[model samples]
Target: MARSQIQDVIRCQYCENEPAVFHCVPCGDELCPRCKVFHLKSKVPSGHNIVRLSERLHPANQIKMCEVHSSKAYEICCKVCQVPVCIMCIQEVHSEHAIGKIQDLYEKLKAETIEELTTIKTQLKSEISQRIKDYIMGEKGIKTSHEDIREKMKKQAQIFINDISAILAEALQESEKDERKYIVEIARHTAEAENFEQTLDQMIEKWETLTDSTHPVELILYRKQNPDIFKLLKLPNKLSIVMPSFSVGQINKSQNKHQFGKLITSKVNLIKSPVESSKHIQPTMSAKGNKSKKRVLERSVKTSQIKAEKRKLCYMACRDDRSAYISGDGPGIQLIDRSGTELDNISTDGEPIGLAVMLDRSLIYSEYDNKVIYKVALNKQKTEIISTEHNPGGLCCTKSGDILVCMGYRGTARVVRYNSTGRKIQEIQTDQNGERHFSDPFFICENVNKDICVSEWNFLKSKLVVLNKSGNLHFTYDGHVIASILKDRFQPSGVATDSLGHILIADRANNAVHLISQDGDFLSYILTENDGISRPYGISVDRHDNLWLVEQEKACVKVYRYL
Candidate 1:
């Protein structure tokens, strides 16, 4: 029924030059002999329901369409065959078929269609009602979950306040005990001084009387009684006391702020407490609640918190699986073994952000102040590499011995690769739409499959962007969520890769390191805060696959068995 068929004289759809000898109903196409064979052989199967126009010449059905030759008009019918026919079909295709007018069967067909609609309507009504019931149940479940979460958070806040109050009470108790001892010592010294003062006053009075009376007997008596008293007065004061004072410090300020209590005195001013938490009238945990709670209170307290080996390690790069070079909270980059033993140190001019290894196995490290990525010789010599147009953040060495540098300025970012000789090989910047991908890209590394992975953080989110060897995008990975700290998002600072293609990223906010697959899927995490990891900054894997963590606040590097 297309208007094009009227003006175009019904040409074959397959072979446009030839008049269509037949129209195929199922295909909605007109075809000549050659194209019809191609369609019948390859395009149509026994499955296609088609009508030839010559066979559909009855008036009622003809206006609709032919079963095979679907578009042309059929003007004749063979009464003996009871079938419709066109000129070519009557002669070559359906010469022996009986034909009839389709107008004669229209009323019966229309009646059948109306009857079928009733059955479809009844079936559709039941499905719609069931779907509506499911939607209502789903809505109720969502609201119930929201209500449960809101109530739980409120309870947690109250529990947190109780913990803080307990710490304050305990710290105050320590000061009180010290004050009581000071008061007792003061009272004892005051009583002894009064007795000495009394004896001296009496002796002086008796001496005055004896001198005025000129009596040798009276003077001798006073001298004999006061001689021992004078000796006692001349002796050093054993009860001398310095004033009582109390000192306090933030307990693990960089770690858990919730549990804090420091008892400071002159003899032990900066000593850490033996107890991990303060004594409190704690609420008895419900048997049901104990199974799921993972807050700091629920976790077991370690006896000795692991501190750093030496100065703070803010940045780290692996020399091998056993040792790494670190920089932070100190001037020089110190090489330390897996056990945190200092092996070597290379002095740097400023605070460093990241480090990498070059093809020559010489160390390359980036500092916060400079545009150039500096290289330190194994012999402790220093030299400047190429200067970037922007401040460099992360340096990662590719297997080809080339270096990939993260560069950015004015809140924009890109990655540039350079050969060992300071020649820029390629730059990977914007996406296909020409928008920069990073807010503040910090550390980067390469996966075993040659995918360059970059860790980036801004106020909004901390995420990783991975690119293939040719700088094409692979996927982005955001850090995993911690149920204990639901309000705070994960932020990555340090990045590293293990031999098994697992990526490790250090998070300062959560005090944990996130482990992810090489293809950017989140795997699991190493929770350090529970084990007393404070402000974990720099991260690296040693040759034995032990994880080296820089405890920033404690100014030390701690190692762990991660493999």
Candidate 2:
């Protein structure tokens, strides 16, 4: 059976012909498809079992082995020749040249490829993470921008609504005034018409009685005699009647031509930074000397160098060793210490113009705007309104506890004395030398012997006039020096008396506080620097002989303590 199976199956390796016997006997296998002998046994070394071939080729028996030298298979590459070769080829042709094994070269190449791919993957992950973060941040920014836009739009809409509401309120008020005027006019005209009709009816009744059939001659005589009555009964010159028109559109158009939307669009503006409504205070620092030019406080006591705090819209009154009282135009009075720290606040509805402390420490203030005097308790619980006949401007409490008021501007500057129970007992300064004591008296202060000193505004001379308790002319302290310095007419606003009986006047127009002796001697300036006192309005002297000055324009209060 083995002989019959191999009968025609054996073919040449290079030629398609049956081979009688196998030609290449290295593997001892027949060729197929072509009768070319790929490998053959070495004839020179016949029994050595060595293989050779016409050309280098793969072995038919072993897939990975070389046919020429199967024992020395392809295990290395000739680096110089750049070709795969066996160990035998290295010894034959590439022995002296550099060579490397195929497995080692392949491992190195594989490691490099793996490293490069890993690096590329890491870079891609980092790039993707950054892109995601950027996208999220961009989205958040867009959201915030949209919210801001919406808030701005809402504010704009509210502004428009407020504008419209204000306009409507004004229109309603005008309409109310017009309606009242029209109604009153119509009522007056109707009453006049009724009176005219009644007069005509009375004349007709008299004429009808005279024209009765029983008295023809009497009627003629009566008509002839009473011709004036008929003339008087005639309707007086065409009743001047005025009928109101209901065409509010024409009136509204004539007054307010612009529509609500157009008006708002034209007038509405977005305010970026509104001005603060609080008062502003100026701080005081050391001034440089004239010759030495060194910054120093003028007074010996450092406590005299007072610093300003937050300013308040108020009028400054009395100042003692510990505190000063500030009466605001609003509804409260603030008590501040020498350090400008607020200690207490007392509430009063009346705007206090002038304040004076009684001997018992009770406070009395004149409400010039309300034309009344009020007594404020130290405990801030009791407040009594003392009704005065004159419109009081300035007030002063005497050593005897009698209150004196300066009635200004009414041409009747009279001082009325009030008891502790607020009773008017005496009238002082009524008429001096058969002429009025003052045209407009502003301020009053008492001396140690209860002698009163008053400041009077002389409109004729445009100067200040001083008067004593007996209505005797003391002196006229005009701003002569101040007028020379400012080159204009200077007016004095406030006056005070110190412990030494020195007079201090606030020369407001010159922005300085002037000091004078009781006998009208012009002393040295109390405050002369521009930065020290600005628009000084009120002046007061504490028990310590220090000067408390008020800057009305700047809403500030400054204290200057004497050494």
The TM-scores of all predictions, comma-separated, are: 0.44, 0.44
lDDT of each residue in 210-296, candidate 2, tens digit only: 766546888778767876875465564455556555554443654443432222221223433222311111111122212122222
What is the alpha-carbon lDDT for the whole of candidate 1? 0.69
Superposed by TM-score, candidate 2 places the C-alpha of residue 462 at a distance from the truth, in angstroms, of 4.6
Q: What number of clashing residue pairs does each candidate have, in the order they appear?
A: 27, 10
Instruction: Assess candidate 1 and give its TM-score to the true structure.
Output: 0.44
Top candidate, metric TM-score:
1
Q: Candidate 2 at 96: error in angstroms? A: 99
Each model's C-alpha lDDT? 0.69, 0.63
lDDT of 2 at 270: 45
Clashes of 1: 27
Candidate 2 TM-score versus the reference: 0.44
What's model 2's overall lDDT? Answer: 0.63
Clashing pairs in model 2?
A: 12-34, 12-35, 13-34, 13-35, 13-36, 14-34, 14-35, 14-36, 15-34, 15-35
Q: Write the per-residue lDDT of candidate 1 for residues 399-451, one digit (tens) a residue.
A: 78888888784355888899987789999887777777776777888776888
